[model samples]
Target: MITPKASPAVFAVGSLTVDVKGTIGGTYLDLTSYTATASSVSFNPLGGYDFSFRENDGLSSKRTLSISLRNLLIPSPPDYSESVVTERGIFVYEYDMKSSSTIAVTQPNPNLYRYAFNDFKLSGKARHTDDTREITCNGFFLLQELTWPL
Candidate 1:
């Protein structure tokens, strides 16, 4: 017999926050967009006609998070402070997604994906125009592990 297919789940952004030495702070409410990138490098050894072996260098792996927010009159605290940029903290991205209804029915909670950057830095450039002003923060995630809640 043919089996039925389940519907695709819909995921939405819940919130983003930074944790500094156990103190958590929220970003401006006008956050417009955010993106994350995880990457690594690989080496390939070529034989006579084709590649013989492929290897991945664990040390080359890196993760980075970038966020764009609407400019606020007040300056961001330690998260964006030059004196504290080198400090390590946890960057969290919470997501709300539709769960599978076939197994169980219940209220959905936001799922969190946390990244522990050994040396988290908050640096960005702000652009001002006649309409609006936005700032973008792009920094390194100096670690390789990402924690998830199941």
Candidate 2:
């Protein structure tokens, strides 16, 4: 849930128009199911996360942006358990084999636990004294499952 954009607009804070929304909660282990909220709540987002998005300033735009992104995957039959990094803005999560730090999924890789989320994340921080583009991240997703014995 990390989104950055820059479309048809002057840069340098001029002709500005920002729309940012974020939210994230931890404790996952979908183990397949593609996480679509049939129950078992706990930071639901259909059940899937992966956060980080901070780009778009233009420096002083002249109108030129071709940004586009879309990635979502979460569905398992069983095998997904991660529980660290507590929370991120709210995009993708599932990696807490104990603790190490390095989210996005990495333990075997085969849809480890499975994911399925889209809650919009990465918010600007700074107490909002005015607005300066804060930026935040920590939405990891690592649902695993892989076996080879031939």
Candidate 3:
């Protein structure tokens, strides 16, 4: 008898929470989509013509998270407060996905990927009548943590 392989899992966007001054916000704007990008720098040392050496520059790595929210209605004062535009805060994003039997059997049935952006600061915000409002944030790095079905 042949063993069946585990099926692929479906992943979805869970939630995005903004922590401002120890208070959590971001309930007013209807978040539609978001994208996270991370980049690292590489260094190459001078070597012989036949040999080359390369190394990753961890210190120059950066993480950027951009979110687009539908402007269903006007946001309240606290939801998109002025502080969010002026001050720096922390952003937490959660992604959930079901796991295959083989993976689930060893770990949790469902997998949770939590990304925490420290020293996250608002890079820009754009709003237009014909376009969705977008918020861009940049951070030094992202701290990724994993949790089992919860």
Candidate 4:
């Protein structure tokens, strides 16, 4: 007799939240989608003819964040500008598919993952007549972390 094979578990994004506090202050609850591009690392090879002999420059390129939100039917566009170094900037949160619910499983299941970004600035913006807006933010997030809930 042959046993049946089991399918792998599925992963998905459950929720997203973006909070901007600086020259502009608002909590974007209507997040349609968002994308955070990875930052580039800077390094140099210390020894010749050996790729393994490398030293980190202790620097990384800035991260690019693109966000789409549902139009809130406002009269004017919100201001997101810099004026003499504003206080706390933007913050983004992403939760896994298991964040909203609990599951009962016989085996060990992976805990949900969370990603948070801080110190972002508005780099670009766009508005569409179709009731949607896209904004881009650039930031040098020195503290980027992914961790599970306690």
Best by lDDT: 3
TM-score of each: 0.19, 0.17, 0.21, 0.19
Q: Rate residue 60 of model 3 by lDDT.
A: 23
Q: Which runs in model 1 stand beyond 4 Å of their true positions?
A: 10-114, 129-150
Residue 55 lDDT (model 3):
18
Per-candidate local distance difference test:
0.24, 0.23, 0.24, 0.23
Candidate 4: tens digits of C-alpha lDDT, residues 8-99: 22232322222332212233333322332332322223311101101111223212222211211111112222112125633322111111
Query: Candidate 1 on 1-150: residue-level lDDT in tens?
Result: 965555322222222222222112323345333333333212213311110111121222212222211211111111121111213643222211121111111222333222222233332322221122122322322211123333
Predicted structure 1, TM vs. truth: 0.19
Compared with the true structure, the alpha-carbon lDDT of candidate 2 equals: 0.23
Q: Tens-digit lDDT track for model 3 on 69-132?
A: 1211211111121211214543322222121111001212334322233323332222211222
Score residue 57 of candidate 2 by CA lDDT. Answer: 20
Collision count for each candidate, in order = 0, 25, 0, 0
After superposition, candidate 3 runs with Cα above 4 Å error: 10-16, 19-114, 127-150
The sequence of per-residue lDDT tens digits that candidate 2 reaches over residues 28-137 is: 22211121111121222443322222222222211111111122242221212212232442221222111122123233443343222223122222231222221122
